[model samples]
Target: MPFFTVIIPLYNKEKYISNAIKSILNQTFTDFEVLIVNDCSTDNSIKIATEFESEKIRIIHHEKNKGLAATRNTGIKNAKANYVAFLDADDLWKPHFLEKIFNLIQNFSEARIFGTNYEEIWDETVKMPHNNSDSLPKDFVGYLNFFKINIKQGIYNHGSVCIHKEVFEKAGYYNENIQLSQDLDFNIRANYHFKLAYDASVQMSYFMQTDNQLTRSSIVNKTIPNYDAYEEWAKSNPDLKKYIDFERYVLGKRLKKNNDSRWKDMIAPIEAKNLNWKQNVLLKLPSSALNLVDKIKLLLLKVGVKPSTY
Candidate 1:
């Protein structure tokens, strides 16, 4: 069996699919199979993926257009290798991405989850901010501490993560109900059941496409169920409720940016004593005032200034 089953979820990423597949083919570690889960793309994404002549590549088409969560779950169920790695069709991986992850597994043999650092590719001109650790840490022990570490510094990108297949049997597959932050949901479940390790070197490329991206459309359409999903998960795990409340504050900012009034109801201003000064103040503002705040923030962004957060 192959050492890792690389699962690439494809939608309408025709422009970037070739490079994504090529990156996998060029990996320094070669004991792997590429499982391309095409979620009924209407574009040439499928054509580009199938053009790869490598025997390691295989394509599976969804009869209907399933969302990201279902597409990922499909790939996990069909993965043949002992470990599964996720790489979005628009993302790229360094030649040693898999090799480094394999080394981490060998170093921390007791760990079930492993991932590497990643860099975001915005455009040809601007450089994306770097927020990764200088070096990889030893295994992270518990879910609560690990979640806090993620809030302070990102734990890992989905593209850079490699999970042992057994974890899925215990933690269950990705929730198919959520439209956005599905990867975070899966990681929360997996981390709760398994120990985690990471390789700090940047090894994955996260493309920040200006258009044709899910985040772009999801923002306007109100489909991201980030708050609800996390709140549901937090119900059974009381210790993690604080983290879910934290998500509420972050989501409030996002909804305010979109001029979305849904943010008002989603946040409980009375029970939000845990929030910082700025967050609490924002939550107290009326919906109309929130839009004005969004406009001011946008003006600040254009002038290269951002509101300070606590």
Candidate 2:
């Protein structure tokens, strides 16, 4: 049996599907199968995906359109390997991505989740996220304090992480109710139950400028994760509570700018100590002021100056 089952959730990503498939094909560690779960693409995505024929690649077609979370759940159910790795149809992995993750599995057998650092690509610019890996040793391979490290910038992306199948059995499958932040909901549960093996090596590229990107959509239309579900547990776990508070602060900012009443509920449970002085001040600002701040932030970003999201 293959050591890993690489699951690529596909929709209408025809322009980048070839590169995504090619990256998997070029992996140095070849004992893996590729499953492309197609969620009823209207474009030539399926056609392009089928052009590269190989025994290791299998394309599963859904009869109708389901969202990203459901598409991923389909891949998990169909996966044949004990370890499942997810790569979006628009992302690309380095040749050694699987090799490094395989090494992590051998070294940290107790960990159910394994991840590597990745670079974010936005048009011609490539930037590393502000993760908590700076103090770690080079080529670090060890279990991570998932919530603690994730409080600043997330160390793992959907494309850079590999999960043991048992994680799904215990922590549960991806939440299909929400179209967005499903990964966050699943990660909170998984990290709470299992240790995450992390290799502090950049082994993947997440393309942020892909066509049909769901993240580009407005915040009001999407169903955000129910942070209240973990409220009881977070009360005792400081790291998890702080992590959730940061998320609340970020989402609350967007909701406040949109003048959505849901913003109040989002930030109601957050502890004041968890938020910084700037975050507290910003929360009280009117929607028009928040909109002006957003425009200024965007302008700064264009000039290569990145203001902190907090």
lDDT by residue (tens digit), candidate 2, 176-214: 988667888999999999989998888999875323232
Q: Stretches of candidate 2 above 4 Å error?
A: 128-138, 210-215
Q: Residues 200-263, candidate 1, lDDT per residue (tens digit)?
A: 6778887653233223543555455554545566667653566556666766666665667766
Q: Which pairs, if any, clash in model 2?
A: none
Highest lDDT scorer: 2
Evaluated against the true structure, the overall lDDT of model 2 is: 0.86
| lDDT agreement with native, every candidate | 0.73, 0.86
Per-residue lDDT value at 216 in model 1: 50
Structural similarity to truth (TM-score) of each candidate: 0.81, 0.93
RMSD values, in order shown: 4.2, 2.3
**Model 2 residue 197 CA deviation in Å:** 0.8
